[model samples]
Target: MKITVLGVGGMGSRFALMLHQGGNDVTLVDGWQANIDAIRKDGIQANFNGKPVSAKMPIYSPAEIDQSGVKADLIVVFLKSNQLDAMFKRVQPIIHKDTYVLCLLNGIGHEDVLSKYVAKDHLLLGITMWTAGMTGPGHVELSGDGEVELENFEPAGEAFAKQVVSVFEGAGLNPKYSHDVKYSIWRKACVNGTLNCLCALLDCNIGEFGKTKQAPELLHTIIDEFAAVADKEGVNLDTEEVYNHVAATFTSDIAGHYPSMHQDLVQNHRLTEIEFIDGAVARKGEQYGIATPYCKLLTQMVHVKEQLVGAK
Candidate 1:
């Protein structure tokens, strides 16, 4: 399989290396010149399951992709939500009619932008439980295991979606063709909405947040806001069930882990996807006339933190 990965951060680099090692032709594209130059000079460095593994592959900036006229069988997007529109437009030359685009990004409203780039039948929406982090340019920390649940945007894309799933399976990415990926996406959003945001604000890990006395109440209120917004979007999120799923992460293997948002906003001093995650819910709540005070406040607080940290 030919694959092009957008945004070679921790998750993007992890997927690229895995696919490359899995015997697929993988090329990387990112907006970060430092990352591209680092990989170009030293290849990708990873600590996989506490063991070192490294691989070098073709890397390109978005402008380079525009000039190279590179095309792929699959375009795997793992970019930050804020970079989606500009990146997608920049990479348009690679997106041919039959080229499938699989977006495993965290949050909602991605399909709106993606649909403008590809046919509905060629768009595959997905969510992953996998976790990864970048220690530096061209360096990543990949540990633990996670599953991917994805579905085609249109019924006509089923066969190709399964083929893509098979490719993921071969690459050691646990893939499941979900009958209701929207529910899964919403469930994952609930996880990010509570744990990811709170962890960043509180300056703690999942377990640390979970150990707090206010954890349960905070989780309930935020998830209820998300469920109300999701209901308006036609995704029926069971509040208790979704809350349990997210709360389970507190005691799970990644108990000490900070979420991607924290890695971006707090550690890296970079902008986060809060606008797409919690902020998206808040915006939609306004649209649907649903009160989402928790989400609204969290989104505002994340931005305030962004300002304090001088995040771009």
Candidate 2:
């Protein structure tokens, strides 16, 4: 299989390495100039599973992708939710008639943007439990085990989706073809809306926040709001189940880790996907005449933090 991985940051680089090791022809596309130059000079420098590993493969910027004449059978996207539209437009030349574009981005409503770029049969959306960390350009740390649950955007596209699942399986990606992936995406959103947002706000890691006496109350408040909004969006989320799923992550193997939002807004001083996560829920809540005080306040707080840090 020939694959192109967009946004070759922490998680993106991890997936590219795994698929390459699985014997697929994998190329990378990223917007960061430093990352592109570093990988072009030294391949990918990875501390994978606590071992130093290096692999050489082609890497390109989004602009370089078209001129390089790369035609990909599969394009697995791992960009931040905000970067989706522009990146897709830049990579238009590589998207053939039958190419499968799988979105493993976080939060909700990505399919809305993706549908504008590709046909429904060629689109797949999912959530991944995979975690990764970037130390520098072209360097990443990958650890632990994660699974990906994805489904075709259209019911008639299942056959191709199964083929993509097989390819992911060969890469040890632990792929599951889901009939109800919307529920899964919303469940994962609950995890991010609470853990990611609160951790970034409190300036703490997952376990540290979990140890606080108010953790459960905070989790319920945010998750109940998410459940209300998700219901309005035609996805019925089990509030208890979603709460437990998120609570478990506080003690999971990655408990000490700061989530991606923290890495962005707090440490790196960058813009976050707040609008896609809790902010998305808050908007839906307003549309449905439902109250989402927690989400609304959290969304505002994250933006304030962004402004304070002068985040781009």
Candidate that scores best on lDDT: 1
Clashes of each: 0, 0
Against the true structure, what is each candidate's TM-score? 0.98, 0.98
lDDT of 1 by residue, 1-312 (tens): 989999999999888988888899998999999999999998899999999999999899988987886898999999999999989989999888889999999998899999989999999999999989899999999998988889999999999999989988988999999999999898899999999999999999999999999999999999999998898778888899988888898899888888998899889999999998999999999999999999999999999999999999
Q: How far out, in Å, is residue 80 in model 1?
A: 0.7
Residue 287 miss distance in model 2 (angstroms): 0.6
Per-residue accuracy of model 2 over 1-312 as CA lDDT, tens digit each: 999999898899989999999999998999999999999999999998899998989999888877988999989999999999999999999988878899988899998999998998889999899898888888988888999999998987899899888988999999999999999999999989999999999999999999999999999999899988888778898899888888898789989888999988887788999999999999989999999999999999999999999998
Q: What is the C-alpha RMSD of each candidate to the true structure, in Å?
A: 0.9, 0.9
- Give the Cα error of residue 158 in candidate 2, in Å: 0.8
Question: Lowest summed-lDDT stretch of 10 residues in model 2?
Answer: 226-235
lDDT scores for all predictions?
0.92, 0.91
Question: Local error of candidate 1 at 135, Å?
Answer: 0.3
> What is the alpha-carbon lDDT for the whole of candidate 1?
0.92
